[model samples]
Target: MSKYGLGSPLKVVKKPGETLTLSCRGSGSSFGCCSMHWIRQQAGKPLVWMGCVNSDSSGNDYSESFKSRTEIIRDNSKSMVYLKLSGLTAEDSAVYYCARNSL
Candidate 1:
């Protein structure tokens, strides 16, 4: 394991257009990780790649549906990452996962 896990383990519920935040944190890596990746997996379905933020440059990339509605906030010193999502819909009902290079 990468010593990674969510800050919260509860199921999230939100209305349309609401904001949702999922916090992720971890320690140092030996694989020379440079990015943090987010994924969503709906019930009974496969995972969907949402995006990733390059830790080196603080730059980000997002999937089409999340292009303008998602943001990554990181506190490198604390090894913490926050996934902020907005403009929600029922389709957003899924499990979110945060991962980094398992060095």
Candidate 2:
């Protein structure tokens, strides 16, 4: 199979103490591995380095601030990546980005 742009893009919005889940579709291919990345943006600026979860790699990488509050999970069977944020607050209200890696 050939790798292309994201087939599906999702967004979630929540108030304080609420939960949200964003989803992405992976390309159906075996040559390249699959991965998902999460980013946060505030005040219309690019604060995109929130964290990243590599599905194919089977581990997670996060920014220092998010280490204690964020978790990333991957389900290879469905080609899905999940971002779970608990104990939400006003400070957590920012745009979330999820990207799939084809390599």
Candidate 3:
């Protein structure tokens, strides 16, 4: 594996009012030592910051637009993070991304 790698599905399809969970996994010496963040980009729109979970799973910070409907979780042992969005709608259709930052 690469020094630092992240993976997620290339495509996902969901319907309104449904719930969706997207997973991101990382591999590297420092993979689980920092926060993981989620972002999305829609057609003709700039990327939107969704939220993030601290590395130790102690806290979270979410954008106001997503504060009520989104939840973030991390599993350090597995080097994975998850973003769960509830009450999905057409507005949620976009390309999602997972990113990390040094603590």
Candidate 4:
């Protein structure tokens, strides 16, 4: 899991229409060349592709469930990369995860 890392355990509780942000880190040459994808999976459910940011710095949410409700903002203030997702809902109550698309 060192190829890419998410900081600490994620346990977010927010009211409907709130925002959610997730940050992840990769070692040198670990993730800079890969596409970053944000995903959500509710308990006993399958993983849903929420959004993706290409290595070239462009991205969008591909899920119909997330269209217009999802926003992907890339943060480069630190060496690590961060993605900010806003406009959350009760349906967004699920496990959030980040993965690098090396394929």
Candidate 5:
């Protein structure tokens, strides 16, 4: 078993044609304005920016490839963001990181 269960218990659920909500918590203080960015990494390679959500009010900003496929919404009161991927596939498998970008 792995410490973070990456290899042992890979908690991946295939949503297929349905929309799946992936929740993430930011690695920043809750009191300040920390914009969250979603990044994707495949096979220990360099990470690619998928989208970002402002913790204050504005909704989200996504890359061109994610225009109609991905969404990053949040419940700021809970300090949590929900990432919904409309379509799922084997190629979508990667390590997603939720980072905070402060201005």
Candidate 6:
């Protein structure tokens, strides 16, 4: 079990050329002080670090492969983080995860 509980949908379906938005809601006192990371793992494949956004909305960074197609947003007031991916394709399918980390 995790000290800070994070909630997200079990699955999402989208078609090619469509956009997808995934939400991650976290609960804990320290949630607002940490950065949120979005990662994905395909079947039998290694985890891929997609991107991250600061809780304070100070900044964000994305992996080279996802830089142009992904966006991460954090809303501390709602204790939620979001991952938006555009120009989707079959190759974008994967199991996504959201993790919190202290600065």
Report the lDDT tens digits of candidate 5 across residue range 1-103. 0111112223556756776666764433551376667777778688888887776757689999877999887666767776777887777778766666645
Q: How many residue pairs clash in each candidate?
A: 1, 0, 0, 0, 0, 0
Off by over 4 Å in 3: 1-9
The 10-residue segment with the lowest total lDDT in model 2:
1-10
Q: Report the C-alpha lDDT of model 4 over 14-55, residue by residue, as the tens digit.
A: 877777776776556545576767787888999888777667
* TM-score for each of the candidates: 0.84, 0.71, 0.90, 0.78, 0.75, 0.89
* Candidate 2 Cα outliers beyond 4 Å, as residue runs: 1-13, 30-32
The global Cα lDDT (0 to 1) of model 6 is 0.84
> For every candidate structure, what is the RMSD over all alpha carbons to the true structure, in angstroms?
2.6, 4.0, 3.1, 2.8, 5.2, 2.5
Give the per-residue lDDT digits (tens) of candidate 2, residues 18-75.
7666554454653136556777777767666666666565688988987877888877
Runs in model 6 with CA error above 4 Å? 1-9
Candidate 6 lDDT over residue span 1-103, tens digit each: 1223445447778999999998888876778987889888898899888988876989999999999999999889888898999999998889888887744
lDDT of 5 at 5: 10
Q: Write the per-residue lDDT of candidate 3 for residues 1-103, one digit (tens) a residue.
A: 1112444357778889999998888877687788889998898999888999988999999999999999999999988898999999999999888888854
On the 0 to 100 scale, the lDDT of residue 88 in model 6 is 98
Note the Cα lDDT for every prediction shown: 0.78, 0.64, 0.85, 0.66, 0.66, 0.84
Ranking of models by lDDT: 3, 6, 1, 5, 4, 2
Q: State the RMSD for candidate 6.
A: 2.5
The deviation in Å at residue 8 for candidate 4 is 3.0
